[model samples]
Target chain A: MCLLWACLLRVSRSTSCFSPVSCSSWAAAARRCNRWVLGVLAAAVAAGTAPGSSVRAAPGPRRITTDGRRKQDLAWSPDGRLLACSLYHTAGQIGVALFDPAGRLVRLLSTDPVEMAPAWSPDGKRLAFVHVTHSGTDGELDIHEMDLEGKTRRPVIEERKAFDMYPSWSPDGRQLLFTTTRDRTQEIYVSRADGTAPRRLTSDPSLKQHPCWSPDGKEIAFNSNRDGNFDIYTLDIEGQNLLRLTRERASDTWPAWSPDGRHIAFVSRRDGNPEVYVLNRDGAGARNLSRAPGFDDCPAWMPDGRTLTWVSDRDGGWDVYVLQP
Target chain B: MLCIGEQRQEWCGGVRRRALVQAGFLGALGLTAPQHAGLCSAVAGRAVILLWLWGGPSHLDLFDPKPDAPSEYRGPYPTLETNVSGMQVTELLPALARRAHQWALVRSLFHQQNDHGIAGTIQMTGRSPQNGRVHPHAGAIVNRLRGNPRLLSGFFVLGDRLQQGHRLIQGEGGGQLGVVYDPLRVTYDPVAGVQLGEVQPPRGVDSARAGRRRSLLDHLAERSPTPTPARDAEALGQMYEKAFSLMTSSEGRRVFELEREPPKVRDAYGRHRFGQSCLLARRLVESGVPFVQVNWSTHVEAEEDAGDGGWDNHYRNFEMLADRQAWPFDQACAALLDDLAQRGLLGTTLVVAVGEFGRTPKINPNAGRDHWPGCYSALLAGGGVRGGQVIGASDARGEAPAAQPHTPEDLCATVLHSAGISRTDVLALGLPVEGEPIHELF
Candidate 1:
């Protein structure tokens, strides 16, 4: 896998400025080389005679707990070791805490007056969260970042009069995408990691919020009220070529792209109480994986593509839960 | 010679009488001052409370019921008789029914915008959104006309500000009229039980400190000296005045204190955010505010599978209508009417309860209704309006107005007029076009 990635990177760089003749020749040579490599690997695996394995298989997600606190919005560290989840409190206070693969609490990341929607940096050195002040004030939200040890707290965006929420780190970790209220209406905005040069991405008069980036960073998925109710939508990084992903009377929100970029998981109220559901990247063959009769939200894909973690209230009070494929 | 002299005197007397008659006629028609001045001045000192139903409430289920409509359209709620012999309100409003004599309910308010954003703009601004124009809200208009000395702000929004799409609802703020004319926005979070957003200082800044800051700012201003626009300056000044008033005036603080009210009274208003908002509106009006708008826009959470909590009941119309939605409104609205009357404010204050538009007359398969802008109902009380009266009617199916349809502009005009503003009070937005207040309601 590493060798293939390296070759693809080299080819992409050469294609950037290659002449038409050179590009065609290079493409042909690459195709022939890929075929030969695949043939040899298949033959060796079939014979069980390979001397050393060159590629590691994708890990299956571990099942943490099924007790039902509706654990959602999982963020894995850059080293792929620790994960963080947004835990909903029945008393209406939202907190963020870290957990290991074995479902053990590792550390408490944030205990703000009100915090939810945690996003980890590409380097996993810092965590960004939507810190809410004064409980129900609409525009009292600010984007905050803190180190993994819950130290060195700093405000990434500090115009305290408008709502700044649902922060998502860019693929390069140099920028962030979040939702903010303009003239009393919610819209998506992208800003630098240091909170400079904020630019609006969507101009619709509907409520646009909960922005999530595709793993490849080519597209962004968000929830909007453009259709008179909440539905999932996607737009390219430049905010063009908008597409609707879900269509029904029920509301769909908090979309998270799978690590492989082939599927998108989201919370929907279509079957009554909100539950975790997944649809293909092309928005086809949609299915509900968490069919339990309880409210579920904030679906996050484990590094191992086969497991999902979410927040649910099935056990009465909100707690984190995991599901396995 | 003596007879001719007498005839000349008689002709002179006749000319004087003719001039007197002409002046009297003009005055009676209100083209002059005396005839209508008393009528307008009667409400000059009184306050006005505007009960803004944020999402459009259903007219058929509340004020304008059509019992003969199909089951899907009518739902399960029945119409009940009010104190007025020939009039009836919905069963959800029994408390209001008993006190029907204290309020005048208009059953035919029509507008073109069915969407919340557009409709809200029209209802608040008194101008159709289709006119491709925006105007100041009715309260702002009142504040501009009736300048007050003791009060910090003439107009106020009691809870969360009105919002739509990515914009605050037009007219909810001072538009072209500038921020000085903007309503004092008091935002509060019920869960936190704390006021959020802008808070003006209650007392004047210490003289020495204020002088020092003023001089420093003024020096900076002189260097820039393009003269910040007048509107911007006015808005800043208004903010300063509001901050001073809020921080200094005991009355202002007391008006916002919900805990000061009798426990039973607070409970009677319900523990919900909107119910408390209504209670606060009454307090503001009583405290000498010229205009108070209570916005019911807070997000109320209930059981996940429960019916509608907000008035935007797109689905499960009957279940929401019977159980969750209408009950709180029924209790609080009825209580408000009674409370206002008991306080003797019903006669002086103009209290209106209305939303942007009405719901669809037809019910969808999910037992919900969509947006309907054709016709709706608005209730008006006090400010010398006659009680026990229903002014308009809907067709048999409650689909559209059968007679006397009132536009949002007319309602705004009525509110302004009740607050002693002449229809000709020009709110100079520096635009070419001029706004004319509605005069028919008075």
Candidate 2:
């Protein structure tokens, strides 16, 4: 079992070079078990430290879309070429929209109303999103990753009764992080990119959704309210080391890591209303970024780490606002 | 015995309404103990818009903020000062806080049932389910007491029937009064505005043909699972009357055309489901609909999953409320109040906004509040009721009523009273429990 797990863990880390043997049913179990062992061993040997760099001061905020449609939960592609956002097509209608950095519509991947919260796969060839269906007694939320063409879709799990939503792909595109009620409550979960080999990372679920991966693939930073209030926390890929990054009585949710993994951008209500805040990996020097009036949330960092995009209702209704500072 | 406010009953201009609730009590109320005809009448032309929060909203989060309580109970949000002195709401509700003087807050509402199905039945019916004899929803009761002739149905639910999972909440319909009194439910979406899906006449079916098919209203309600067909000849006649009422009443049909309103008006209500629905409710009452219950969502737990859900935030309560629920409510509810008052409809239209119950006082491991029927809050406005007042009070921790703890029964009675239904008339209806109106508002 150890040998299988070790081999599977090695194969899992290499996304493009995954062998068929590592993707077998046993591989999922092995990877779930052996990844922790390998990660802990690797952490002890490596000087586990991230550079503490912050965002530099920059320009004013700009609106991305003015079509008057409500957009939600943005994901900046790994290549920094485009962004995928959940767009409101009409009332009771929501779909994934892909837009270039210039706010031009590259293409609408899917116009299906049930789909929401689009996240781009590291390869940029595919997009993972929440596909909501009301077939079950209660509405069901499932994660589905599809190509940009909107063809060829598959569920994250072969069969799921519990609600799954807001999927985040690993940098290597081998694993996906999402929130699921598989355990009868919403919790952070990690499954293989193919939706096999499911694993539970955190039992404490406070709905501080959207767990993002570090650029180095060593740690995963997410917002959790397990400590009485919503705050950001970082845990190693192995789930062995967990560190609280932001300490605020107010909710500091939706954490997004910069490309360099130097700074983390998260939304906070510490200043009365929600504002975009960026803090170093050590949780120091937290400063308000988007000081706009209405309420700002869902902060997504640009790959360059110089600027980020967030949604704000400052001008009456919610629109994508980009702020450099 | 008739009064407007909870206190100062007789002195509160408690004009005794006479002979309005006459001989129909036995047939309408369907109670075992028959009432005498000496009952006072309910004020006519009075309308009610019940903004059903559906799932239980958190008392600690919305109107009844426990700022002085421990972090475990207080959670994240701090209270913001409202226009009315000493009234504070969650910071997210700045819009509602600014207009606090427009509505009265009842902070000490409590009940025994924490389960969604039971508690929802309690609030909707204004009484607990007893001996399998479910009480009629407050809206149905209001309509039964005083029907609205201008509208197709006396009571209108501006959304789908309220439900939790597969099980329907017991008393959303006419209940003991019979299904004939069920609120005419309509659905509202951004693209569709307000679609009278259930009540819409079939395409190409002229008025004469529609009349021939007296079962038209029976086979209607495609959006609803249970379509109410004509049960008997009398019901069939009533259904036929309803069909012709909407088919011919162009004035009544115009109320559903939400686009007729100015762009500024629609924009002010915010471009969301709850916002648009509230606007429709205002239009409904404006057009003489006696009761309008605007359901927040069809089911209980809906965060981003459904893009909409009710106040039953068992998990992710704060996040859901902040992102999905609270701000829209603040914008739409405030807009609704402002619109009613601006149109001169506020004086006669009674608007009640409340969920079934309140959430738990202490925060749970899921970072959400559980169901708590022990203490909750609601907002009451218009209908000749005085504003800028806080009724009752919650304890320091907001775990229970600190003073003047009232049940859902009182809320129902208060709604009826505000809509011109007198207390003695309610007593004459043979209701299992007659909830007294909170006389403080008058």
Candidate 3:
């Protein structure tokens, strides 16, 4: 049985190789014999592991944001002095935090259920993000704005019984674009900077999420799964002239427009695993910027556009890293 | 009170009555004649198809939407109005939402065990596990009460075999009632064509040859004749007869052929395994099978099989459900309800769908949900259940049942009751039945 299992594993790492019809039987067999096989496999895996292994800094991709907790939705302050991110702490507590340009922890801006697509105000005085008031069953999600230097936080847009998230401020900071599920499906919406008078931007049954605004505020780029899988898409601020940027079968998501608007930095799982990729504005010259293992996702461009910061689990846990693009 | 007395009388007399019936069946098996009259009277003619969602699905994100909760607890989705006034479900279930008049939900169904197998045992057997003994599954109990009628097995489990690592999960087999009452297990991929590997005879073995072999065995039994050989021979003969009937029966063979359904009808159920399995389940019940369980993807481990859709969404709960799980479930369940109603089988067939438990109210940092057995929900449709009604309520944050919660046993009692088996009836049959049917569901 062990030899047969070993042969099966060696032949196919992906469950795709096995016939779906027989997988049910094999899965049943695996469950029945997994305990004994697990021990042997564990021993084999342990023997394969190098002794006294620890996470070491890889050659490229310098580590930037380091707090031993999860960090997501990263954005750079206009002057490049600070980084704003949705920070997750122990005991299910979550909030937004600021990191200095030198990779040091700044004060946590707000520690509530801060979720999705944190953005910096053009002048860099306030942060906009989706704050989750309650979670799981009977939960509410809304876009929130808070002063970076103060404790004052207010709902920019309150969605009473729906999910309103992924807020991205326009380059002029006068309009905020975000994604909401209030329409019963994910659609893009643009609201006033203060979160009043919101108008629906894009309407589709397919998911349209993680909207990002161009620096010039002329176009809005976001991820859509309308083509069966998620791909980068761009549209005018009025939601007209829709254009699909990336055409790969692999999912390309979380589009971050470069400051100069020449490239869009995004995450793609096209090469079997997620990696940071940068593509030119017209979808040509697509190059993988982060070639490291583990999931490299949510790429945020530094103000200079020559550098990019993203989250990676290559060190066994999520940490922010900056790469010279 | 009258019902209790009648049930008790039946139970007390049933032991001796069953023995006599067994002897008659054995005598009949010795001959080549089919027991036609006995078959009709033995069965209740009613059936149930349980779509068991193997892993614990998040109640918050499915049937029981808590839209007013905070964002972290609210999840990333929104709730939409269903056809039933004042009833709302997550947008992920748009298909089911349109058919709300066909189903009812018990939003307060819950139990203590959170682990998959342990909770599965609780849900399947409708009993809290005791150290020394195992409780019979509802199907097993049904099998014992309504014996197979040579037409079809009383209980059948379709789809992937459920197991935890290397062992079959608890409460899946016939427990205290013994293995003979266990459902006929058919492991097949619903997405691929149905092929009952072990249920069918080996290739090149025709029914005539099978009958000849049975005769040879019978001849040998007569020649040797050990003590109690009649009873053993009867049991073996019964087993052979069942297999032969399944292989030779036109209705049985046709029911397993999913291709026989129209393309539009097949597409309505969606092309996925769960959807296809549900359609197959309908065919099974339509063919007179008493109980059929179509388990939704038995690969229960969250990490390896999340894409396969067992609802243990401990990590990437939102992504996993959004990407693959909810759409198929919504499409399949709605299609099943529609097909059953259109075929006029809904009145006689009871359909139940549920996972073992619910996910935590608090969303973890991984943007996922963990196990929370404190409160959950289950859906019931068809049979005698009143549709478009919510039987119970969860707390403001969905932390626990707002009122007194319904235990797994209560749900089981309701299922049995819908199948025409009263709680007292099971008790009188010398089975350790627990919990009362939720009277509100009737």
Q: Interface RMSD for every prediction, one decimal?
A: 21.1, 14.4, 14.9
Q: Pick the candidate with the highest DockQ.
A: 2
Q: Which lDDT value does model 1 have at B298?
A: 37
Candidate 1 vs candidate 3: the DockQ winner is 3
DockQ of each: 0.01, 0.09, 0.02
Q: What is the lDDT of residue B157 in candidate 2?
A: 86
Q: How many clashing residue pairs appear in each of the predictions shown?
A: 17, 9, 24
Which is the better candidate, 2 or 3, if ranked by TM-score?
2
Per-candidate Cα lDDT values, in order, are 0.63, 0.71, 0.70
| Candidates sorted on lDDT, descending | 2, 3, 1
> Candidate order by DockQ, highest to lowest?
2, 3, 1
Candidate 1 per-residue lDDT over residues B33-78, each given as its tens digit: 2211232342346778887876688888888877677655664445
**Tens-place lDDT digits, model 3, residues B134-216:** 78889877766654546434677886568654456878766766555566655444222554533434334455665664565
Q: Compute the lDDT of residue B374 as modeled in candidate 2.
A: 93
Local error of candidate 3 at residue B229 (angstroms): 11
Alpha-carbon shift of residue A294 in model 3 (angstroms): 33
Worst 10 residues of 1 chain B by lDDT: B23-32
* lDDT of each residue in B99-146, candidate 2, tens digit only: 888889999999888788888888888888889989988887787777
